[model samples]
Target: MPKNALGAAGPAVLALVLGLWGITREDSMWRDEAATWMAAGRSPAGLRHLLDHADVVHGCYYLLMHGLFEVFGPGLVTLRLPSVLATACAAAATAATGRRLAGPWAGLLAGTAFVLMPSTQRYAQEGRSYALVVAAVAVATWLLVTLAQDRPAARAATWRWVGYAGAMLVAALLNWFSLLALLAHAVTVLRAGRLGAGRLPRHWATAAAVVVTGALPLVLVSRAQARQVAWIPPLTWATAPAPLCLLGTGLLCGLLLRRRPGAPARTAAPAVSVVWAGLPLLAVPVLALLAASLIKPLYIDRYVLYANVGLGLLLGAALAVVVRSWRPFTALFLAASAALLPLHLGLRTPQSRVDDVLAPADAVARVSRAGDGVLFIPSLRRDTAEVSPQLFAGLDDVALVRSPADSGTLRGVEAAPARIREAMLAERRILVVGDPEDHPGGPGDATKRRVLAAFFVRCADAETRGRRVQVYERGTSCSSTPARRL
Candidate 1:
């Protein structure tokens, strides 16, 4: 392959190999990914109904995955394959963007940096939309670079601008937060003096307008469903470090590139263009979210995952400069590989997630007898059972009013507090799955725990990664006190 072709292909190959390494591990799905399975595994009409109730932001992605599930089945590999492929696309697009702005050396380094990013690898092996959004952002950035370097009178330029618009539309649809990239693009346009002076700016603006217009319906519906992210805490000084660190890292790398031998003579991209392509895309979103967070907390690192592409581009350029000699470059590559060894091993373990619901699920399967009852404290922990249905197959969810499929909901509907209490009384043995000793005070959960405490005695308890599994026997209570009714 030509050097440029090799540069573009290398990152993609690396991402695929790394992504597949742990794609089908025994690790249990986390709550969010379980939600993906639940949403995507549903019928189209059911998924639509579920979205209308909650998770509207993920509607498009769920629909896309629903089709994939139909063709491929919902095994772990199938669930995560879309993300893996998307990340591979992102790797290639990052390389192409770097090649356009700088040179093949910069492209090769940038693409490699993207593949090696911890966050990139993390999401690439999980079943989620972040990788897809990252891919869209990267392709959009590449298209923007192409458009910027093209003459307005050229027919190819118009087509490239249209492609940019379509990429933006896909990005916005995948995750509404991705539309934030447009603000970065706006800054680039202004910096380049393309606004109002050229056909490119007008076309860019028109494309942006179309994206916004197309996304309006989803934006309105998803905003009304904003309670989905209600768990995000208000921003503070503590929250400032992550974005600052990212921005600082990119800028520091850019500065280091200046120390290269005859740095100005070997330049692949102009300093101004690099700043235009990189700084705004990386900074504007973080700053915008920081500003928005003053009113309501919306800042989360994964929301701006695409910004990592800018950081990778900047870092690649610096690395290219610093390791100008082949011997030093080889040494650096070997050192990075060694450093990543432990991380790669860690990613394959079940304990890598917030909670290895798999361990708890396995424990429940072992202890619970046929016809035993199951309860998920805080309700959402039902995802544990949902993800490993076969392991929990024989046990009945005593508190479940409707199955996830029947209810068209992510976690399924719980019975009324009184009904749940009644159901718990009838079971001889019950399995409880939840966070360890951190019960959220809710009426249904309180009623279930109260009934268990009053009527049953704990038989066994096992702790998993971030959850607990407990078995209780109805007649084992030492207390003679009567169980209270709700």
Candidate 2:
């Protein structure tokens, strides 16, 4: 195969193989993915209602997966396959971008770097829109590069402009934060002197305007649902360094590549352009989010995950420059593979997740009998049950008034305080799933703990990763039931 084809094909194959290696591990789904599964499981109308009330930004992705589920049926492999495929496309597109800007060697290196990055491997095997966003941004960037190189007098420039517009539109729809990529593209155009009185600027402006117009409604709706990001804490100086280091490393690598021995003298300019093409994409989104976070906490690293594509390209170019001969390049690749062996193995284990819902689910399944009652302290621990509904299928949720699917919400609705107390008093053997620290807090949580203390005996308490399971038996041995409030 030609070097050009190898540049694209090699990275794609690596990404696919890496993505599928542990695609169906026994690890339980985290809350965000559980939310994806929950949203995708809903009927079209129910999902639409869910978007109107919450998580409007993810509406497009959920709808896409909903259609996929209709054919494949819901499972971990099916849930994550789209992300894996999208990551492969992103790897191919990254290679093409590097090939366009520099040479086939740079393309191959950049594509390999993309597949090797820990973040790339992490999200590629998980069900989410970030991988798709990365792919769309990469393809759009490649098209923009093509537009920049085209002769102004050529008739083909118009079609290229239309394609760029469509790609940008798809990217923005996937994740609203992807719109930040336009700022990066704008920097590239300005640096290339394409923003003046020329066809390039005119076409570029028209495409950007259309994308913003089309995305306006989603922006408005998602803003109304801003509570969805309330978990994001205010930014501090600590949050600034990691992204700065990443962007700085990419720029530094590009500089090193530009000055490398045996590199073509004429290639200096393209190396600079590679840095310009990538730096803004890596920096602008992070800076914008940091600024916004001063007002309301909106910054999170994964929100701008596509910026890593630029880092991968710059790193690839640097690698190509340092290892000018194929022998050293091969050695470097082999060394990286050996070093990543441990991380690769760890990714397949349940310990990799924020919380392993499976361990707690399995614990509950082992002890609980038919007709046993289940309760979630602080209510949100219900996410465990959502992840493995089959394990929880036999236990009745004593406090749940509406199922997540029925309520069209991420966490199901809870019954009123009176109904919860009544239900708790009636159960003979109740199993409570919660974090240990979530005890005896808030109106509902306090009420549930108080009722359990007053009317039950602690039979067993088991601690799993990030969760606690306690079994309570009906008895007076714990504490006397307090007088009921009318």
Candidate 3:
């Protein structure tokens, strides 16, 4: 392999190894991954119907996973392997970008840093579009660097621009938030010295326009489904800390990348360019999203995961300058690894995520009896049953008017409040599955709570991390009921 290829390959291999270390998480799947599975498992017509109503933002990723599942069959490996491969691709692209702006050592270190970051590692193991978006952005950024640095023939430059545009379009299709990466690239161009002089600005603008044009339809369609993100909490002071910490780290890394007094002009130019590119790529998109969130609350850290590439570039370059030798670098790497060992280990556990969909399924299976009715307090907890349908097969979902696949919605449309009440009252015993706190504020959930409180009594219950399963008997007394653990 060529020297550049070797630099890229090392980090890519490292990412793959880390990503696949405990890829299955002991056969556990969380709500998000379950959502992916449910969507990907749907028939083509069903998936298309789903996109027409909701989750159009994830439509491209769902389609891709659907194709993969059709070929490989659905399992933990099939669900998560794409993310692992995408992370490897992202690491390689990060390394290539670093190599273009700094030295080969800088590229290698940057890729390693990217692969190890907690957020990167978390998303790398997840079955989602974020990893793929990161890969696309990294490759686009590298292409941007190549375009700026090399004054290739017009035809060659146009092809590179086409590739950049295509990469950006892919990122946008995966998740529109990734379009923010272009803003970072624009900042890099505006900061360029010799690189930004001449036709570069015009070419960059043209390619960017192409990207926007290609992604315009998704942009518009997903905008109509904006309510899908209504659950994201508004920006607050607590959310300020993570972005502040990242800014502080980026600032420190930027200071380290500053030129020394005797540094050669050729080297100084590249260092300046790297900082110009890296800082904006690291900070602009996140800060922009946060600023936007002040008005409408769309900020989510995972949205701009591509920024990690910029982080990798700066940190790797800083390490290359400060460590000076492989021995010290290796020692530092080992020390950092030792510090993060517990976190790395914990990330592979079933309890790592917010909630395990299977946990609730297990709870339901233990507490439910044949012909018993099941109710999801907010209706969304139906996802637990969706994930492990076999476990719930014996119970009747009394509140559900239609299945998720049949309704062309995620949780499926629930019956009216009165109908749900009538249905629950008819059941001899009912199972309620939801979060521990019973505040589903929706009308259907409110009605279920009221009816259960007035008519039925809690007979047996099982509580797991982030979920609760309760059996409510028709009568007021539960004297003969036994406590259960799930």
Candidate whose lDDT is highest: 3
Q: Model 3, range 1-486, lDDT digits (tens) per residue?
A: 137778899999999999999999977888889899999999999999999999999999999999999999999899999999999999999888777777777788888888989999999999999999999999999888877767578899989989999999999999989989999999887766455346777888888998898888999989999998999999888888997788779878988788531112223334236687788999999999998998999989999898898888888777777666345776877699679878989999888888778877887877678999999977878888987899998888998889999999889999999999999999988888988786747888889999999999888777775788888888778747554544
In candidate 1, what residue range of length 10 has the lowest lDDT sum?
261-270
| Per-residue lDDT of model 1, residues 1-486, tens digit only | 128688889999999998898786575677678889888878899998898788888889999999999998877888898999999999999887776666677778889898898888888988889999999999999888766654446778878877888888898998989999999988877765543335556777888999999988889989888888999999878878878888898778766654552123123323235556777788888778888888998998888899988887777667666666554775877698679878877876667778765678888877777898999997888888777889998888999989877786767899899999999999988888989786566899899889988898877776777788877778766233333211
lDDT of 2 at 400: 92
lDDT (C-alpha) at residue 16 in model 1: 90
Model 1 reaches what TM-score against the true structure? 0.92
What does each candidate score in C-alpha RMSD? 4.0, 4.4, 2.4
lDDT of each: 0.80, 0.80, 0.85
RMSD of 3: 2.4
Residue 93's lDDT within candidate 2 is: 87
Give the range where candidate 2 is weakest over 10 consecutive residues by summed lDDT: 263-272
| Error at 26, model 1, angstroms | 3.0
Best by TM-score: 3
Pairs that clash in candidate 2: none
Question: Could you tell me the TM-score of candidate 3?
Answer: 0.94
Off by over 4 Å in 2: 152-155, 194-198, 258-272, 325-330, 439-441, 476-486
